[model samples]
Target: MSLNHVRPWKNIYRRTSRQIMVGNVPVGGDAPIAVQTMTNTDTADVAATVAQVQAAAEAGADIVRVSAPDAAATTALREIVRESPVPIVADIHFHYKRAIEAAEAGAACLRINPGNIGDEKRVKEVIRAAKDHGCSIRIGVNAGSLERHLLEQYGEPCPDAMVASALEHIRILEDNDFREYKVSVKASDVFLTAAAYQALADATDCPLHLGVTEAGGLVSGTIKSAIGLGNLLWMGIGDTIRVSLSADPVEEVKVGYEILKSLGLRHRGVNIISCPSCARQGFDVIKTVEALEKRLEHVKTPMSLSIIGCVVNGPGEALMTDVGFTGGGAGAGMVYLAGKQSHKMTNDQMIDHIVEQVEKKAAEIEAAEAASAEAAE
Candidate 1:
């Protein structure tokens, strides 16, 4: 049972939207909110790009987007698509021909701004290619790249302008009778991004791709994305998310999952609930958590662990997690398993011991899940 079941206020009521497929992964409706990231490598560099895509996929990316700026990149995209474990979305900009080439190259989806991809005739051709290749389209509207007319009309980029840009592109797809599409209205400003997404949510039933575009380096970008994406997600507005950071693409996937996990919208590895240590502590809470995080990265079964420095709120927090260690006197602390006080362990042995316990619990959960699935079959 989830904590949300007992606390109604914690529940998030997602907006109703039609579902679309990006390869085998579903976006929108009742689907698990998908996490996505783009490759930083040159698209033409098949080996490096493939390596990054595989790494992101192994880290839990639902989909990976690769830039296809020209013919050579689209040609290389063919190999990347073939090599990727997850779906590939070809990111096309200002070139309808590149969009067509990407669709024909076995891309599951194309991320393009319909307004900027030449005229209606070009857009129709791209849509035809998408339909023929069975590719879904993503209408990406960024604040930095709004149409010249929209800038003239609105005087500057704002939430209204971004939403207007999205709707205009959406109209092109709809005019062509193409419905297999998602849309994103993104801005670097968190406020503008949230407001634009809210307006877009009400204006269309298309799945929304959420992001705070060009969000700074790793630390600053993570903080900005978490605030912007977190609030929108809490409002039940996003279908898929990409964290745009000037960092490794794998970090984007990790941060996207972290945002979803914090909102209880998605669950992946261990969810550690730890307290910041103080003078009353009995163990090195910060160092212990850092070690546990790296050591337990391979545990995919969703669970919780609590590591508290002292008994202030230690025991109380332990009661809610799958495994816990609450610091105490005499060089040892109490260990709780399955939310109950189980035993005591010395500080020196706690890290390795907790890893073993988590692994055991994960295996048990997997076995039980397999049994339930087998019985259902």
Candidate 2:
């Protein structure tokens, strides 16, 4: 491809204001889309907690959050924070002391819902410790556990109600001159969560941490998160996102990236476009696509790759993407690159051939981009 064919990828959306650091990772204000997940392991288990944090980091989490409910978990935070590959976020609920202990233990950030922490004096104490430790905080307000006063006043967890709750927490932080923080008002219902986030986005510039709270296991959770986070992301409303699935936290990271990729907001791994199985499908497309997706887990490039079941739509779909393969007769398929036929190969050869082509083409594209950037500079 020539320079004339290169189109600029401009993300014109208005990013939220405020700047907070989770270790070395910057959240909000034009930073790259950050991937975050919480560890499900017991926080008091030092070894287990450290292991899970490391696992999350290896799986590409930029920030790892762990719940510290007691004094033992508070003590464990020191070692966990020390050993973590990425920044550790100490998640504290209903306990202001744990937040202080987490900050003292060198946690990079603290996740606390201000309304749940109680009293102006206690809040200031946590904030003082956080400022002393140079740690950031996340004001995480959930609909299921909104303040009783706010709930009684609003009569329900509506969007306006959620926004009111978030603002109330924001006021608490602002009252103490604590600006190193982010906010999230999450509800289990997708539409309600999206609406709440949208309202908050309009009201303030704090980096909004997005999620569909208490979103259930694997399939259902993924769908709920995709719907809620995806909608807010499409409107340019989120900064860092966590897909709160009941499944493995790694899956949360994966789904978070997928939402970003789908919105053309960011790209991480393979972008696979495959057809739904039909009578015209010549090969095991469902199996092939699933296997290909799992196999290409580590390919982190902005490359569009397609796997098609039949020639009718395959070649055209492949042409529309960066690389693709279409089914052909007698256990064979045709591979297309940049919309042109590269070669015809056997069904078994399909995966390897497409992967090789993608890697090679990706290198070429990267080199071209570098050269263009240099010329511009």
Candidate 3:
């Protein structure tokens, strides 16, 4: 039984939206909310860009975006797309021609800022190119680049203005008889972004791509994105998400997955639950968790591990996790497997021992799943 069924408050009723394809990945209509990231590497550097895309994919990104700022970038995109482990989204700005080129270069989606992509005729051309290439479009409306007319009408970037801008772009695509698209109304301010997305959700049934744009470096960006995206996701508004951080694309992917995991919307690697160590700790809880995190990075199996410092709440927490370790006296801790007290280990050997146990448990889970699948087949 799922936790949501037993705990009603954990339930999230997602908004109904039309499904669109970004290559082979579905964006909405009951599909898993896809996590995405954009590469900071120069798109013209095919090797570097492909490496970044692969890294993000390994970290569980469903889609990766690369800037196609010029003809050279789009030219390089052909090879990047060919080599990418996940679908590639070409991020295009003012140049509609770049969008056209990107579509032809095997991009699964073209992320174009509608406000800056010239007049209706140019948009129509880009739409036609997207259709010809079986590529989807993303109408990216950012607060920093709202249409001049919209800014004049609203006096500033607000939720009303953002939704209006998105609607205008949606109409252009609809007018061109194109519907394979998603939309995002992003702002740096968390409140503004959340408000814009809420209004966008009510205004259209298109798949909404969520993000807080220019969200800052790793630490700041992760927190801002967690709050903004977490609220929207809890309200069941986003179809896909990107954690915009001024860090490596892989870090963004990791943060995106962590947000999804926390909401119980998605799960991938080990979910570590640890307490901040106090004097009550029998072992160096902080160092042990840090070491375990680094060691368990290669474990992609979805599971939970609790590294509690003391017995006060540790045993209770251990009962709910797949694998757990609770600190005790005499320089040792108790290990719990599958939510039951299993054994004990010295603090010095705990890190390596826990890593071995986690790997073994992951293998068991995978094997059981495979056996069940085979039986069904």
Per-residue lDDT of model 3, residues 152-255, tens digit only: 99999999999999999899999889999999999999999999999999989999999999999999999999999999999999999999999988899999
lDDT of every predicted structure (CA atoms): 0.92, 0.85, 0.93
TM-score of each: 0.97, 0.92, 0.97
Q: Per-residue lDDT tens digits of candidate 1, residues 192-305?
A: 999999999999999999999999999999999999999999999999999999999999999999999899899888989999899999999999999999999999888889
Worst 10 residues of 3 by lDDT: 1-10
Q: What lDDT is reached at residue 10 by model 3?
A: 78
- Candidates ranked by lDDT: 3, 1, 2
Give the number of the best model, judged by lDDT.
Answer: 3
* Alpha carbon deviation, residue 50, candidate 3 (Å): 0.9
Candidate 2 Cα outliers beyond 4 Å, as residue runs: 1-12, 365-377
RMSD to truth, every model: 1.4, 2.6, 1.5
- How does model 1 score by TM-score? 0.97
- On lDDT, the stronger of 1 and 2 is 1
